[model samples]
Target: MDLLALETPCLILDRGKLEKNISNMHKRMKTLGVNLRPHGKTAKNIDVLKMALEDQAGGITVSTLKEAEYYFSHNIIDIVYAVGIAPVKLDRVVALIKKGARIALILDSVEQVKFVAAKGQEYDVEIPVFIELDCDGHRSGVTLDDSLLLDIGNLLHNEEGVILNGVLTHAGESYNCKSVGEIRDMAETERAMAVKCSELLRKNGLPCPIVSVGSTPTANFAEDLTGVTEVRAGVFVFNDLVMAGLGVCDESDLALSVLTSIIGHQKRKRWVITDAGWMALSRDRGTASQKVDQGAGLVCNVEGQPLNDLIVSSTNQEHGIISNRMEKDIDWDSFEIGSMVRILPNHACATGAMYDRYYITDGSTDIIDIWYRINGW
Candidate 1:
């Protein structure tokens, strides 16, 4: 099917760009001498995961138990539930473990360690876990110098059912960096913090086997991964406007976009409206703080080429208003009522969650294949 023939407000994935992105990240990890455990939260599709895991270690980092279950059902079992585990979810985790899934959980607090250990004991399954560390204080994790770090590590190491697999940290602040140099620094800090925590644990007679750290910005710009065992990144698979704005990737490297049609127009206001509103484009204004604030998304022609300085300036529940960012006159005649256009998302992960499937293309209008997404918790 041709792209134009597909329904509006649908996801379009360029196979060519997708392949290039996966290859580039894998090559980057190979050069850095670290394993790449691509995060499954972005695409949420097994086909994309398979492409990412090719010629690399066979492990995945997922944000939810549903993702772990889905990927495990497909036989991709070496998993890490990167989010802090809720006590109520222990049963589901144990169910997967009982079925032979070598999945690991991450937690920061001593209370969480006790809960996890107790649950593991209840199930009589040896559960693996990583002590989350706060590298740059971007989000969750125990600080490297926190006294609780040793306590949690010792508890997991000595606990009967739970085992301390390693330490994990994310340079989420790398996304806030204004330059590549800053991202590189953030990467080093992330790696150093994880490695230091591991050393602290090992020095105290505890085993810290894995040291994981990553964020797309850090993974792409990291100078070295000397002591880091694995890197986890997701948005790199479909570079978004936010990533492009951060200088992590060029706009042309983006593989995912929302296909929308010009539904109406306001000639005097030079506004071209589209069917893709926040419902389709996503409410993630991730690029708003960047040097270049792409309103909702950078507007492009149906062929995926940017149309001057066009952008989706504002959106309602079902209406997207496209206008020139520089206040230039829009060529109303060119964007006719039925003409189709594409909108690059600000955050690929959020925009991707708005859809159930991806319309695959080879950087053209010709649709070659269709891939399903695993959405929900």
Candidate 2:
């Protein structure tokens, strides 16, 4: 069925773009000489996972345990619960391990280290772990020159049932880099930091096996991933307005979009009101601070071709104001009250989470497939 026949404010994924993105990422990882453990936070759909992994579940990363369980339930066992593992979640991780999930946990503080160690000992199962090394201080992770990494490594490896898996770092701040050169520098820093941590652990007589590092921007621009064993990136699967703004990927590479219908119009103000609102498109103004401020998202036609100079300027709970970014005259008659439009998201992970399922297409309106996504904690 066509998307026009379906309800508005729905999610649609272009299959061609999706495959191309996956293939491009795979190729990038291949050239980087690292295993591509694509993060599953974007599309929590098993179908999307299968495509991204090319049916080979080498290793995947999840931001939430629900995603870990969902992917594990689908028989994809190797996973890294990349979020900072709270002490209370040890039981859940143990349960997942009992069910044949080789789930690795991330740790930054010594408290987390001790807690995980205690749980690993109590459960009598080897808990694979990674030290979250800080790269550029974007988010969680120990400082680059942190002396505690040695202690954390020893705590994990020396303790019974706890195996220090390796060191992992993400230069998430790489997203803010101005040019490819800056992204490359960020990627190098990320690689160097992870490698340095792993080396430190090894020097301290700890078994540090995996040296993983990546962010969509860094992974794409990095030339030397020498010591990096694996790469983890999520947003590259579905390029967004932010990625396009950073010049990492083009608008054509964007796979996911919100299908909306023109419900109302403000002729005097030249605003085309859409059924899609912040609730559907998400409130992530990731591109707002960039060179191009694509208000909520770049506006597109029914078939997924982005409309020139059109953007969702403002949004209410259930309504979106689509206007000309150039502040030119609106195409009043073209977008009839019932005419449909597609909206490319700013951040794929945030925007895709709004919908439960995605309508799959190949740039055409044909709904070739429907994939359900896992949500919640």
Listed per model in order, the count of residue pairs whose N, CA or C atoms clash below 3 Å is 0, 0
Give residue 281's error in model 2 in angstroms.
0.2
Global Cα lDDT for candidate 1: 0.94
Candidate 1 lDDT, 105-222, residue by residue in tens: 9999989999999999998999999999999988899997799999999899888889999999999999899998888889889989999999999999999889999999999999
Please list the C-alpha lDDT of all candidates, in the order they appear.
0.94, 0.89
Q: List runs of model 1 lying over 4 Å from the truth.
A: none
- Clashes in model 1: which pairs? none
lDDT of 2 by residue, 23-48 (tens): 99998878767888989999998888
